[model samples]
Target: MRFEIMNAGKIQLCASLCMWLGIVTWTGNMKLHIWSVFVQQSYEGDVVFSVLNEQVNVSKGLRDGKTFSIRSPVTRKNAIEHRVFWSAWLDSLSTRVFGVEHERAWRKQVRDARVVVLEAGCGRPTNRLATFSDGTRACVRYGIDADQVLGETLSYYLAELLGISNLPPLALSKLNLSSEQWASVRGHIEALEWSPNAIVSLTEFIPNVTGVFIPLHLRKQQGGLQLSPETVSNMTVTYLVELMQWSDLIIFDYLTANFDRIVSHIFSLQWDARVMERTTNNLLKTINGHLLFIDNEAGIVHGYRVLDLWERYHRLLLGSSCIFRRSTVRRISEMKRSGDSAKLLCELYRAREPLARELGSLSQEHALTLQNRIDVVYKHIQQCTDIM
Candidate 1:
């Protein structure tokens, strides 16, 4: 229940609450500055954005079709430290300091917001620019498949269930789009919609992010560029090594049988060295690179199609070797040894039980399936741990 708020070039990183005029909190892992806790109502339930009652000009973050470049240099020392920091954070997830309860509260605060659709991007599932009612802007994806969206939601729950940070806060809400907005998205849609309100999943977009250094499979999909595994690994290891998130993400994908995670979907945040120097923030200054997982709508399909898809991508997870850190395995081992793994699973089951009643049919069945898969995943973890 703690957040470090940055304002007017000053940062306060403590758990204690203080009263300040027009305060806004950083809403994502990027730690980029944005609006804080101002509540309002929209067509959706509750919209919380940063600007409260004041008018401020905040950048919507590269919406003008500019190419974001990754110019920040990554050294060996920084990469190792980044790996260590992230792995340690993953290990801390199941503890009292960062458990499911905290995850729920934090997620709710970040996910519920009223957003306006900006520019729409290409793909089967589309990307859009959206601004919160409080004027904080982000990129979003509308859920094309109800089952997939439910699975994505459950994945967040699973991340909470495992006490790890996977995807950023994904808000499930209705959005108001103008006629222009409707026209912009018409090519991507299957049916007609005169109605201005549409239910969408809004993922908190990170500002100043450059495209990630994708894996070979993703590169092939993009344009069929082939590079040796060593060359690719060497390039990626400059900015990422021992990526604990990859381990957890792959485990999640396996549990859900998701296969859409191509390398191009990962994002890398940009660091302004000049800004870092001015702020004198040690954390930001020391580790200038971070990776994020996005586009999680391909999981938990309702039919046999997922089986075909899973077969295609399962090797990425259970591969003989990759850049993923074995931190997830170690964490699982620690949890089982401390008698918390089973307890944690019970907590997840209880948390998901009501959803089984609320969502009904496919989701309800999938909820039960999810719990069963948790058992399978535990066994998988045991196998990995034994080998390790």
Candidate 2:
């Protein structure tokens, strides 16, 4: 028995040493290959060397049983090449999935048209299903507080700026009973006890939207959403379209720190282990296979305020996938480089909304936080690109 124990100990030590040597050899070869590619392709050597250093550290960590901070679905040698193709495919997609011109017209209509009716049937009691004089319908969110309205409105613009057309077109309105837009709904507004001059937001009411389920790949216990040529080739066109939108969804949520959707499900995993099987909150799918991100009232303002408690879950969701849309990454990179994300967002909001002064804007502190979050997301994407 003593001899057997000694032999087992020796075997374990030898196995560990072999693993370490294998990792070192692999790292050295990967560095050399990357360096050669940089030289041959005329790519910046400094960036290539930095990425190589990171890869070496990651290899060392793996050998020591340490997990990577950002996880990738593709772990094969051709992952970087696969990622390039995937990003190009995403970038090649039309940015007008929701019809940018139509959305602009819809916003104008929603903002200018008269509100003919207000009913209590648009998901929540505070949100009214409204009819405009032009016979168009909208969901009017009479935010419980100013922050909620600000969050929803600004989040929409942020998505727009990022070239993500998932959120419906939004316009701001005030609860003035004397205004031509709200005069017809005065009785209903008064009955609801809404204060005069309270700012609210109106979103285009999408018909025939169904709840979206978390994809099996994202719900897996091990890792989330692998991106590779082999994996993508097996996917049906519809699945691919939805996954493409989902990639944007993840990035948007991470930047906004919006925990009311996937992050909430992750948080629920502590108690309801099967929570991921359910439909995602605030996510809806059109019959044509486009995803609509709804109820963004929790995104920027409230989401940032509660970041202290929810940031880990936010990071967990953000770090799950290595793939992202190319256009989205470009926008993020630009914002990070310019350091004007918050300023740009605010300017867009104020310019578009006529009652911007009444509604107010993001505080200086929150604006700074928003910029910082953008920087963090940019860095994470850079790290992901390097690893891939």
**Over the stretch 53-153, how does candidate 1's per-residue lDDT look in tens digits?**
22222222211121121222222232322222233322222222223454465446445544443555423335566665566555555555455555555
For the record, the alpha-carbon RMSD of candidate 2 to the native fold, in angstroms, is 17.2
User: Model 2 clash tally?
Assistant: 0
Error of 1 at 190 (Å): 13
Candidate 1 runs further than 4 Å off: 1-117, 122-125, 175-198, 214-242, 263-288, 302-305, 321-365, 368-372, 385-388
lDDT per residue (tens digit) for residues 90-117 in model 2: 2333234567888879888778789998
User: Which parts of model 2 are misplaced by more than 4 Å?
Assistant: 1-87, 90-95
CA-only RMSD, every prediction: 15.5, 17.2
Residue 302 displacement in candidate 1 (angstroms) = 4.7
Give the distance in Å from residue 46's predicted Cα in candidate 2 to where it truly belongs.
34
Could you tell me which 10 consecutive residues in candidate 1 have the lowest summed lDDT?
279-288
Model 1: lDDT to the true structure: 0.40
- The top-ranked prediction according to TM-score is 2
TM-score of each: 0.49, 0.77
Candidate 2's displacement at residue 263, Å, is 1.0
